[model samples]
Target: MDGLGNYLAPDHRRCDDYFSAAEAAALQGEWEAAEAQFNHFLAGMQHHFAKEETVLFPAFEQSTHLTGGPTEVMRMEHAQMRGLFQDMQQALASRDANAYAGAAETLLILMQQHNLKEEQMLYRMCDQMLVRESAELIARMNAIAQ
Candidate 1:
């Protein structure tokens, strides 16, 4: 059976792929293609965030009996990313490559740091502390509506 990290880490990569594709399209000034790819990336990110926020984080908090630790930090970071998402969306709507690049660069940095924390620390801790509940928690995450 896969642990939390094993199950969730692949999603980060999947989302990254869409993000890269969107960036490539935008760089080429292919607004149609960029819009489609950006939408895919946005949906992927929103879905991933939903899985963590709704399922994994809640379970981790319940198990650890602490609400003001890693999960809180992750939530705050998620909000920051959401704001950047809006900026990117607006840039896309305007076909403003400069704005898009600026927002994407910021988002990319935040995502890298955020993913590192989740992959290196939070997921590992979840795998250990919630080992017995890993399957159930993953199942719940999977069931979340995109």
Candidate 2:
């Protein structure tokens, strides 16, 4: 958790684990567990996105002075994922497993792609460019309201 990738990548996995648990519970017809797990997953995702959008991305943009670059793309992708989150939430509320499955599938794919870009490119750039500010940046990100 010392570097951007080190911290953020593990967060991604944590969210994914929650997602998997929710999906498994739904598949097993455990509605209560599914709802609980889905809530945890949703909260984890929103918090992660907030940390990046409010802290990491801003720091990267300011340090590099490249506002219309990776951060912009990531923001767009975040919006897209938020839409899927709504869809999944609606499906869960209605206990519609099929609809949830579809939305979850789309979200899973998007998350995989998004995480790859952040881990492989954006994080590496942040690590190199913001090495001096890494500690402060991570602290700010961690301080974001959950």
Candidate 3:
């Protein structure tokens, strides 16, 4: 079942919306608005990562007896992407458009690739190997953990 992945897709879409807006804002030279949008993107993506890392991924690992599975790669990517996001935030805060633009480009690429990987690979694998576990993971991830 793709239950968990389906549930999480909204989180990815929300991130997409923010980043897309950031890109548009940057193009229009709306620096402060772009920065604000990027900040919103950062917080949302971080929350999305937390739901996966702390709940969905761990639960899938537990249910399927898989350690250092696909989630490991995702977690690593999250850290790297987050580092870039932090750099972007700092540059934006300092009103350094040159730095912010470069970082923003990097973030766009990272989010696109990361979201693709999760939706196409990791989540699909989880759906196959942890079908029964999806419901349980979803409940815990969206509820008690919140």
The predictions' CA RMSDs to the true structure, in order, are: 0.9, 0.9, 2.2
Better of 2 and 3 by lDDT: 2
Q: Write the per-residue lDDT of candidate 2 for residues 58-141, one digit (tens) a residue.
A: 999999899999899999999999999999889889999999889999999999999999999999999999999899988998
User: lDDT of model 2 at residue 130?
Assistant: 93
Instruction: Give the least accurate 10-residue stretch of model 2, judged by summed lDDT.
Output: 1-10
Better of 2 and 3 by TM-score: 2
TM-score leaderboard ranking: 1, 2, 3
- Compared with the true structure, the alpha-carbon lDDT of candidate 1 equals 0.93
lDDT of 3 by residue, 40-77 (tens): 88888877888888887887778778788777788889
Off by over 4 Å in 1: none
Residue 41 CA error for candidate 2 (Å)? Answer: 0.5
TM-scores, one per candidate: 0.97, 0.97, 0.87
Residues 50-145 of candidate 1: C-alpha lDDT, one tens digit per residue: 999999999999999989999999999999999999999999999999999999999999999999999999999999999898888889988988
As a TM-score, model 1 comes out at 0.97
lDDT of each: 0.93, 0.93, 0.80
